[model samples]
Target chain A: MIAKELKRGIITENSIFVLALGLCPTLAVSTSVKNGLGMGLATTFVLICSNIIISIVKNWIPGKVRIPCYIVIIATFVSILHLLIKVYTPTLDSQLGIFIPLIAVNCIILGRAEAFAAKNNPATSLVDGAVMGLGFTAALLILSTIREFLGGNKIFDLMVIPGFQPMAVFILAPGGFFVIACVMGLINYFRGKKGAKAKV
Target chain B: MTDTIKLILALTLISLIAGFAIGKANYRTKDRIAAKQQAARQGAIDAVFPEGFKIKEMNDDGGILPQKYWIAFSDDKLSGYAFEMAGSGYAGDIRFMVGVGLDGKILGLTVLEHHETPGLGSRVNEVASTKYIWFPFGGDDKTKPWFTEQFEGISTLRPIGVEKSAGEWHRLSEQARAGLRDRNAVSAITGSTITTAAFTRAIERSVSKYLEELGGYCCPATRKKREAEAGAAAGENGEETEGGDDS
Candidate 1:
């Protein structure tokens, strides 16, 4: 039972890469390690908090108003986080930009609210949120690190090799789409092979 | 009359309850939100000037504070000022924090915020690339090492250097500690000359404002002649006031 949750959160599974969710910020702000971390942490806070609250109120909310309720709860948390980050970490605040508020529509957060939290106890829902958030953050960090290093030839601002011809395109919008394609492609390829072997 | 009265009374009662609840919630959170904003502002000030600063005063026009602040040093030793600098680029607004030293030299600068068109204007953020002001003129900042070097120890008299773009002039003047303000020239960023010039103008204006408005009467030798020119201009305008008031 414990292992299942761990597996679901860690490998054999991923929220962003494998599941193909929250691709907007995954490609947009994941251009740097710092951006990835900031977005990841903020998402985790909103997801966990939203999941817990949505679970508690799931029974009380009319089906018609459920989506709106979840959205309000999520948006409120996101705005608080946005203002908090702005006053505190202005650089990170600016770096994440509009994506910070777009967490309202991140789909992953809302998807979990409907699929997992609405049906489960608040306890499992909270864990599921945290795990999913973590999974998403980890994937973002990996993709961003790859892009920054290959695209800019500097990992976290420390120049490793003196004369590296940075793949100029890797840091732009197209580079972002390309990186997503590659990451998703890899996940599908490996996951597919594993599933095939399991069936055999 | 009886049905109409009953409906009106019911509606009024519901509205009253709704208003009271909303008002009470807003009133409670109003203070909390204000406190949070103050804390956030304090945090930004601390991060920028960890040495600590004084509010000194506050001014605003209306809803959007074009420049939300006017912070000064507590010790009075630090001249110049720190504030949000902004301007229109080829894309959206480019915003940044500019720090000017007492000498009219750029103490430090950091892009606080911006939303330039990606690839074209976004290159401005790539430090060390020389594609933008990412180069540090002569500082420890790896990305912008020494590009701002041109900005250091510059003349506050003429905000725009004469012949060439401003950056080149700053670069040239750095070699010599000439008291004469160089209106010579600085190399402007190609293709994005307008963008580069706009940023330079913002920095120059902010620094000059600090010097003229609040730099006190201690005009450096570089500004000596410009001082005379300014006095002459004031005389021409016939707005010359008596004595000095360092408010």
Candidate 2:
């Protein structure tokens, strides 16, 4: 059961490519591999903690006010994570900046709470959170690697080619959109092909 | 209704727990965060000055100068002054330190904090390098950011010019840099002119005025005259005067 859920979260219901959630932070911080990893881990930490807390308190929370209650839990975790990052990893804290706090509103965390965690057992919810967070991190790594290499002719701040003139646009807003669209399109293509073969 | 009460209770309980957790987290991390910030500030100050320089914090005296500034002394002689300056950039606030020599020329500039668009405006603090990772032989890594490096040796007395057409400072040759220095200008970062302009404008707006006032304060003749005046005024009033020896 855990393996099925893990496979489902990491591939079938992957947050970025499949669900198209949390694009704001993904685009903003995916300029470099380091920033993407930092943001991903920060978001992952928030996701895991919030998922566990919401699952534990799912019984007491009223259906009518569940959203706000979930938000409060998620925000608390994000704030704590923010403070810890600020103290322990000041460089990552500065790099991630507002996106760290903005993780509270990342639909992935709230969406998981409302959709999966609210109804699931704590262990299952924890698994779901971890898988989903890993999925998001995977998507970010792929996107950032492409963007960083194409935009700066470097990977993780290390130069890739000797004196390769990078296309500066790949580091800009338009480039972010272009990269996301292509990646999403590629994922959809493979998924569509697999669905067709299964039906056949 | 009991249903409404339950809703409120649930939210209130969760919020209370969250608040407690956040407060506890803040309490735990506040000291470490402050220490980190202090260390960064000290590092920025040290970067702007040479080795073995002593920093002395000067009282603002509640004068027109709004920011707190420090005077740097080397071997009992005034070396330069360092102060924090802030201005709005393309995305958000950009705060940095500026060190100016006694001659009003900028010694160095370092960005302390900024919230700018990553990969673009943030390049203001980036040290540009052409060194390849595998080869890593030909080009050298830059210690200071090219954007801030260009500001060194530019006089704060004159209005600093941002030449957009001249290209980025790192991309320019030696002759081009010399030409820019002669004209009291620095090349703006491509596609981030606002960030570059904001930093230079901040230096131009604050440093020159503060240096003038600081010069007057450090002048021995003016110091003697001001002391004599303060003494006479204190004798008459029998009380300490404002803006006198408060440092």
Candidate 3:
């Protein structure tokens, strides 16, 4: 059952692909696979930690001000994470830059906190956060891989196609939308085929 | 009424706890963060000069606000000076470090912080050359970035200006590559002339200001004379002092 729920987040309710929760950071950082992966892992860390804490203190939080309470908790965790990253992993800190602070306002985190963590047990909420975060990361990775590979003729900064002329447009802002649409179209096509076969 | 009071108390308690936790984390990581920042600045300074150069921060005797610079030493002698260069760019301030050699030539330049558009203005930070499989259609062929690399070996004594028109380099024939290596020319980023011009102007201003203020100390002969004068003054009454050491 828990396994099924986890799969649902990764597939059926994938934040970027299926639900389209956080698109701003998705588009901005998806210029490179490395940046996408870094952002994904950072968001995942914050999500799991915040989900567990919120679950533990769900009852203590007042209903009238729960939203503000979540913000405070998320902001606190983000600050701690930011400080830790800056101190221990200065390279990643500089690469991620402002996005680390932006993670606090990411809706996927607060959405999950309100919908799942607040209502569920600590263990369930933890799993949900992890699964949702992994799903988000996976989407970003897919999008960035395509964008970086085609746009820069490189994968994770490695020269893949030795003599390919990189299409500079693909790594730009509009390229993000084009790639996402194409990927989404492919995913939907496969799903539609499966649905037709099931009907038969 | 009772519920309202309870809610207020709960919110206050949560905020207090959250604040305390963040405070603790900040206190724990404050020193490490500061150290890392210092290391980053040192790394930038190191990149501005060639190998085997030590950077010593100079005191703000002239009281230049927000612009702190350092002097470089190699082989137990002064080599060049690096300054924290900044300018109002397209979006926000573009900050960089520039190494001006003893002969008034730029040794190197490195962008430290910037808030330009990601794909366009942000190209200022790009170090690697864009490669093409076939003919190099792009005029920029050097492994180093054309924007800053052009400044290398170019004397700051001349006025620097960005290539304002397109195909300016393409129009120049192979024979003119050397003779047309304008001492006062910098290649601007395509589609981001504002940012390119901003950085070029900043470099020009900084170099001229440095020349006017400390031109005497930059040359070997003048530096030796200044040192001898300081030594003689010290022997007489210990009154003369150069810029104080920052590091």
Candidate 4:
């Protein structure tokens, strides 16, 4: 059961590629693999913690106030994560500056809380959060790898191909959109092909 | 009405729990964050000045910004000054530390903080490394950012120019660097002229004024001239005004 959920989270219900949640941060911090990873982990941390907390308190939380309650929980996690990052990894803290605080508003955490965590048990909610978080991180790594290599002519701040001229536009806002579109299209095409073969 | 009250209570309880958690986290990490910031500031100050130079905080009574400049001493004698200046960048403010020698030439510069565009403008703080991931240990380690390294030896007495024609400092040849030095210019980061210009403009606008103010405090000629002027003013007023020039 856990393995099936993991597969679903990572592929079918992937946050960035399939569900298309939390694209704001995806576009903003996906400039480098390091940054993308940092952001993904941070978001993942928030998602897991918030999911568990919301699920545990779901019985007590009134339906009318559930959204606000979830936000409060997610925001608390984000704030604590922000402080921890500032103290432990100041470099990543600076690189991912405003986006850290903005993670409080990321739909992935709240979406999980409302969709799965609110109705599910704490144990399953924890698993769901972890899987979804991994999905988000995987998508970010894919997008950032393409952007970082094509835009900067380097990977993880190291030179890959000597004397290779990089396309500067790939590092800009438009490049983010182009990469996301192409990746989404490719994923959809493959998924469509697989569905056709299964039917056959 | 009871249902409404229960809803309010649920949200209130959750918020209270959140508040408590965040408060605890802040209380725990506050000191570490402060220490990290202090260490970074101290590191920047050290990077801009020569090794083993003692730093003394100067009085900024008549300066534009208080606690912005510090006096660096070598062998108990005044060697130069280290300054912290902030300028408006493309996205937000860019704060940096710069060390200038007695001869008015920049010893070094290090960007302390900035909020420019990540890939473009943020290159101000980027340290260009030759370390290839494949080879890993093959290339030389470069600690200081190549962008700020070019500012070394540029005089602060004149307007600092930003030139894009020469390309980035890291890619430039020796001859091109010499040409830039001759022109009292630094190569601008590609596609980040605003950030580069803002930095140079801040230095040009404030460093000269700061030096002039420092001259009044240290330079014998300027001290004598200021004293004479003060004495003349005192005579006109028929009163003694000493140590009153600094406000």
Compare the candidates by DockQ and give the number of the best one: 4
Number of clashing residue pairs, candidate 1: 15
The residue pairs found clashing in candidate 2 are none
**Model 2 agreement with the true structure over B1-247: per-residue lDDT tens digits:** 9999998888898889889999999998999999999899889988888778998776443333433567899998888988777767886778888888999999888887787776678777767877776877667777788899999999999998999998788878999999999999999877788988888887777777667656644643453465576674322221211212121
Q: How close is candidate 1 to the true structure, as a TM-score?
A: 0.63
Which pairs of residues collide in model 3? Answer: A163-B133
- Winner on DockQ between 2 and 3 is 2
Model 1 reproduces a share of the real contacts of 0.03
Question: For model 3, how does the per-residue alpha-carbon lDDT over B171-192 read when each residue is reduced to its tens digit?
Answer: 3455543433554676666557
* All models, RMSD in angstroms: 9.7, 4.8, 6.8, 5.3
> DockQ of all candidates, in order?
0.09, 0.65, 0.29, 0.67
Candidate 4 — which residues are off by over 4 angstroms? B62-65, B216-247
Model 1, runs deviating above 4 Å: A86-90, B1-84, B89-94, B97-150, B153-198, B201-247
Q: Sort all candidates by lDDT, best to worst.
A: 4, 2, 3, 1
lDDT of 1: 0.61
Question: For candidate 4, what is the DockQ?
Answer: 0.67
State in Å the error of residue B166, model 2: 3.1
Poorly placed runs, candidate 2 (over 4 Å) = A1-6, B135-139, B216-247
Error in Å for residue A191 of model 4 = 1.0
- Specify the highest-lDDT model's number: 4
Q: What are the iRMS values of all candidates?
A: 8.9, 1.5, 4.4, 1.5
Candidate 2, residue A13: lDDT: 91
